[model samples]
Target chain A: MEEDPVELVVPEPIPEPTPSAPPEEVEKEEQPAQPTPPAEPTTAAPPQHPFLDRKDFYIPPASRLPEGSELALAKAFLMTQSEKSNLNLYDHLTEVIVRILETRPGNVVDAFETLSADIKRSHFVVDRPNAPGAFQKASEVAPANEIGAAQVKLFEKSGLEEPGDPEAFGEIPDIMDLSNLWEWAGVSLGKEETFMLFLSLKSLVTSKPLQSVRLWGKILGAKANYLIIEGELKEGAVDEDAPQVEEEVQENAEEKKEAEEDEDVPKRKEKPVIPLPREERVGVNKYVYYVCNYAGGPWTRLPDVIPEKLQASRRIRKFFTGDLNHKIVSYPPFNDTEAQYLRCQIARISAATVVSPSGYYTFDQEDENEDEENPQPQNIIINPEFESLSPEQLIDPANWVHHVPYILPQGRVTWENPLGQKGEEEANEDEDEEEGSDAGEGEEERENVEPETGPGILSPLSSDEGP
Target chain B: MSFINLDDLPYLTLVGFTLNTEEKAAIQSSLQVKKEQEKLEEIWLWGKILGVQRDYFIAQATKDNLFSRKFYYSIDLVNWLQLPDVPSSDMDRISQVHGRFTGDPAFEYSLGEEPEEGAEEKTINEEKRLSGTVALINYETEIVPRGAYYRDTLHQLQKNVNFSGIPKGELSQLTHYLHFREGFDINKRTLQERADAFDESIDIFETIANDEPKGVWSCQTERTGSVAILRSLLWPGYVFFHTANPPKWGSMYYGTGQRNLNIGFML
Candidate 1:
């Protein structure tokens, strides 16, 4: 099945409710039944939160929500009370979660738990930090003063070292060389920290093979700040307790094959691996690994790894972690520039289209309109072709590809072609003719609604049509 | 394909016109022309005013083999001359060029002053061009892979070029247009912004080079690796320019010819 798509679109404008009839008319309706006595007015209910009041707070119809949490499925059954109300409670809940994550000042778990049942049903669960199991029951109890603290404690208690910190787990292996790697990268570490680096290498072995070990060793020796660590090699000398030399030969053969195929997936740039090794193991020292506080070297050393020197210094650890997005630092602190820069960088990397600088000769597909009086060619960029898909279908990761030839039409042919300027005159004439015809018909304002001819009076078409 | 090799420095002295309403509008419209064959209309017109005539156009300025077109009001693509040891602003240099020509009576006469109440129409004298003429100056242009000049600073050219004699009103017109289009000081913009500005200018040029209309035709010479064209946008008459790859012109043809005039292929 294709990935579910996500898209951001401007919400359609909601029309305001029309004013009710005058108070006198309402009074007349009340007194219509033969001398009925007036009852005392009751106090109105307090307003609900906007998020809870939204249509999606109610369970959606089966048609609108094909897949959702158990809570959403339960709510959909209750929504049968009204025929007009059909909503997708899960998507609405997800959007609410995302909004809370962005704007609210509370922990993600606390925020979700504090919302009304309508906003977040008890059965709905989110894949948040510290919760690894699929669809774990959501917490109903709101933790006080422990915003995001429990998640950290859960990891610590589980005997898992924090990401990028292998020494905390005490899995340092024997016969591993790390001080040499740190020295090459110009990183000064204490004796204990050097031992930690050795363990970190062993930790990396879970995700990487002996070939990865060889490549990383070369990278460390070269003083490169960043290196991609593929997950631990599954089949290795360690499984059979074979000699380390034989394992090296086997890994080299595998790596050569992988390196050749690397070109096929060019979009997967900087394949850094965050080794989530379950446990540290020692096996004839078949591979070596390196770690340090930071990739503290001149960007020149890791030119291929971190080519964009503009963002090199800030992106060191983030680069190494790869898909394991475990984080240690809070973002958008007093100085939020780094956070904003990272956002733009991510957007650039994620975009499927590439717009190269102009004036360089590339394929000139702009000549399609060369026959016109004026040829206004636009800068080349990919035009997305998501045929007939709703906004939900547009956000799929699969939809974004590097090569899709869907360029928009080029610019106008003539700047001041007197011929094209007559559009306004013709529109005005049509309006005038319509008015004249209406007058001839002598029709009453039965509908009392404005005709939807042309764009509204305030539109550019009206201005241009005017003298 | 035969090619003409001309000196590049002199035409800087000769051609002049502004991105005025009529001219800018013409070029803008031509750039946006839908027909591939007509895209070069504005460029051909500009080139024709620069005295590069082609046989394809039957312009009012061209009557016979004998040359008839004149450069009364035209825009030139020329740089301001920087003298050694003299530190002057680009504005002052541009002012000097304008100052030299605005004083000429013939230029004043060509601004609709000479043809008094339809007495008779007369051609412009080549030496006495007007002050209002625009001189597009772009220095330090890098030849991109496609042979297009990218990131050349026109605002700098506007500031440092001598425009001494041009009236304040005319000068403001040029400055206003440049500011409106490329921003007041384009150099201060980010790399992406500068790239965008340069790309826009190239879009205009690309339209002119590849597209040919009734009176406009441009083609790169196969023999000499230069682009040559004839056009009549600048004046009532046709002007032609044969620009070599490095843009040193060898010969120029100013005058008129019948419709469907075929100047031999440059290539």
Candidate 2:
């Protein structure tokens, strides 16, 4: 009986030109009386029509058709005209269907109307009124380009000017060149660190109106090391009375008053302030310091150094903990934190050891032209007539004179701090008098006299003097 | 102390211990005077060992031979006090005491047990331990490039004046470095290992490459690959740097003078 049904079903031919006919129509016509098992062989046979050769347009046997195949074929047939016209019918239909399902409107036609109105109101699909086939507005086509331009403007507005383009800023000095100079002196922060510092310092110069910058040195700390960069501020950029310095000075003065009260010492009258010999731009405070936790971290400017802090720093030896706010608890307590201590140490190091070859700097002869009674403090200027010293003389310590002043024990180059108290000044004078009375100590007398005579040209005799 | 000048002093700043210009000048001048007065063969600043009160500035000198080198230390740069010679037995006793230096040369550490109890408690001075510790570290981790010194006709080890330096490329390799101590035992190596490389006269010390508990030495090139900096993992803050072209070298210890005893576990 099954054989008869299979033979009957196989012999019949249905001529169909369209591939989009529904499966139920084919099922009802082809297998009217046959059971499913007997109809399988006839269904497996190839379709007689020529259009079935196109795989995507081919219709499966009615019984074997997958779920949703009829709806898929209908959608495909509807997209055929738009495909040749460069339209994205598939994406549009899928988006509309997804929205309809999401909104689950009481009426399906209403959802499409509302979605179209919402998209128009939001300007997601910009419409050109005069164009044919609903063309989009020009502004909606190139949004990426606008975003990129806005980002460029943001960077420019932030003042983070890109470095290494010489055209913009005429030939700024490369800080990496300093690595070669320091290496010649047997000092370096290694190649990797120097390059990183160079990049970071270049960024720093752009943010601040700096005339020049250099890697001062690295200060190793217990937790993390600090990379120090020294820079010269532009002419009008320097803040003479920085707020941090003012706060530190006030705190120091209060501490001093408390200490004096504890000692039961009589308060003395304030003396006439002596004007500083030279501007802070020339001597110990010439360079502004910035430190970062690492090569590329945010740089923090250290507070200006005060004389009392500088003196106190020399009395104690401690390692930095890489924290600017770390309190230094020693016998003679540091008034400020590690930042001030670091500044004080830098001043001391620069004052004592920062040397240049002998003729690189010369005493300002113009200062000598002033009246001797009220002589201006001498300034060291770059020598126009500088002649390089021989290697022999350059190697000798005697030839390397300090350009900066010797920071006296009282912290200033001179004892006449106009801002200082008369009691402290008198105490310092008494100490000097006691040292002067000791005739056997010729070395102490020379040290006391060296600062008063201006910058000491290092002599062979001076190396013999020990503290 | 010509080996350590103001130029070379900045290298110590890398490892974070620096003497101010005054202290450095004083040390340089005073050491030169001491060298002349004592007629020493050679002298160089060993390093600074930190103490609770004050740091110890150590200077090492050789008298007649490298093996006869002595160490002198100072709290104040003006005075150089020779560390007392330590006997072999005291070296073991010194190992039992571990702590930061008191900055007092006279401070004594009691070892083993309380004196009031029945058990005997040995006492050791900080000065002796300082000397022993320096000697021990030197014997273990102090290294020089292989050809830096050679055996003379009299079998005396002498520095090679003609030795330019270890090449820059080979500097970071551990095999190029040898311990600057005496007593190399060739028998410890396999026959294949010593087949072509054994020489009793010149090869008088072991190579750092064969050191046990691997990864104890970290060698790196710095200063745009012109200088080599080698740090000891076994001794945390001991650093050695050498320049190939100009042929300059120095080592400084800026740590707490304590051995990294957990090195085995660390590896």
Candidate 3:
């Protein structure tokens, strides 16, 4: 079975109720604190404050969020550059990538328990005093990025009888050195891919091999903000414990003064956009793994194993111990071993069917109900062929990606039976007289209600914080 | 401070035609109410002149400036039949370039005033143009905000604020319109008292503290970047401006455009 991604859409949020008095208002009066409605519980567990998750795969201050967290992060990261390079790459890729994370009818998921890395950076700076601007200044030195196809593990000569130690497969290469590989693109400013519909990588989800220390070591040493994992390497999967070395740096490159904001101009023009790591997989014949994605985030000195940074920054420790989400999906082994896994997959989901109120689609059903209910029902189907299915056999709602609303003459409109009313259109005069109403009332009243048209108006009313 | 760009000002001038009665209406057919409405319609046909955005709109002058209580006529509702428009279809062509010819007999003849109704006839050699046309209100605008200028002070006075808490039944007819309190309370408040209070507060916020430039200096070749806020004419429905086009030809020219126009209906 494919590692199908599922999406759920709640109604648009209404404005939260204002507290009895706003915090600014609270500054004035000495009144007793008035109890107010509490906020809704966030999806992340209570113990995990969304802002502290420090898993190794860190989305830099400027990278586009995982497909799920895109919008929330869009407003959040409006002022930060995700890459280390001073080159203005964020501008080139941000909007396009957002268009890519376009899975229809889904809300942003809280993949990182913590607020984005940029917010933490601000809170780190403004929230403290005595500290020098060194941390902020240090971030200004542009980061280098690398993007290459994924190396998926195809088939390890199955360990028949007794297998050789799974450990001695190959020597772990130094990650930072750009010279050890078949290919590499250093300081790649942004990353992007064209998502083909119905083609997605799911092997990343099923092969959760975190048990190995070598893979962890390799990730620990990688010097890229966004690491793109490809399909080929995934076939020959590396154990998680692969030991890797950080790339040597060319010292003496100077750091530029970061942007100092002023009163009038918008600070947005100053920030850079980050590109997330992309994995590429192709031509998986007889593949065992279905599909999966791993966005190799920014290069970070992982404090999980080396906790010096963790000791100094509770924020960092919290990310590793409490917030990183390790996703895993599994399936029964199939006869075609290699066909089981897929990597570097991309898919395009369109919102074309989302009609007026938003985005459109419709359901088509059999005509068995022609003599039944007042306004007949139209069945929603999976494919456009409109093959009639039993009411119970409609396309599974889970896969019915509602990128937009249902629209078109695709839905059935009831026709007035021609045999029943020859003069139905002009029956108003006769009907009123037949109903025994007064003379002046015969004409339609000023309020002639129209049949609903166009897109249904989604309520713009903000969600009330409380009753 | 950010520089003001030309694109910010909505328009160079606002030509609001305030109907002497209702701004919006629902068609009703009661003969008695219709009769009263007819009288209003007739009166409004040649209504009394109120005022303009300020003296800024007046192309020419009146006998009074300092002694004139013209501010009371902030937003003037004029009777279209009373005051003649520039009369010629060539106003767009008559801008300042050849405006010097404005004083010629031909110009006076075009105005149908060669006989010099309120003005004296010049001797054959006398300058065809009157000695000079003065502005109604001369504003000393600068980079800093002139409070009254931004408030659209002249337009504010024309607002009818004399309502005595609106009659109980008229609640359904309309809601209170202005945000700030108006001095007058309609018939209940003494007119003299309302007038005094209004006059007292009129010049309070006259100086602009954050003075962003306003108006279009456009003559076709060099265009203002933001069209929405060209000149001081406000874009419909937009009340606030966050951007402006840079000044091109000049910094701030206290010109004829800010002159006051007579509103109210002119019979």
Best by TM-score: 2
For each candidate, the alpha-carbon lDDT, in order, equals 0.27, 0.63, 0.22
Model 3 misplaced regions, further than 4 Å: A1-467, B1-10, B13-267
Candidate 2 TM-score versus the reference: 0.43
True lDDT of residue A265, candidate 3: 34
Instruction: Kindly report, for each predicted structure in the order presented, the TM-score of its chain A compared with the true chain A.
Output: 0.17, 0.52, 0.16
TM-score of every candidate relative to the true structure: 0.16, 0.43, 0.15
The residue pairs that clash in candidate 2, if any, are: A273-A418, A274-A418
Candidate with the greatest DockQ versus the true structure: 2
lDDT of 1 by residue, A1-467 (tens): 01211112122322211012232332233122111111112212223334532322332233122235673456445323322233233334443543453365656666565663545343334335345444322221112113224333433433665466443232323423544444332222333323333444454444333333322321111111123222223443343322233344336535853664575443114432111111122211112223221222111111011112212323332212211122323222212223222322332232223222222223346546443432334223332432444556445433333321211111111122211123355334433545565533322321232322221111111122221
Regions of candidate 1 where Cα sits further than 4 Å from its true position: A1-467, B1-267
Local accuracy of candidate 3 as per-residue lDDT tens digits, B1-267: 111222222121111111111211211112224335333321111111211222111111112221121111111222111122232333322222222222122233233236557766432211211111111111222111111211234543321233222211111111111112223234454678557533333322322222223221101100111211112211111111111122121121223222112111100
TM-score of 3: 0.15
- Could you give the interface RMSD of candidate 1 in angstroms? 32.0
Instruction: For all candidates, state DockQ relative to the true structure.
Output: 0.01, 0.03, 0.01
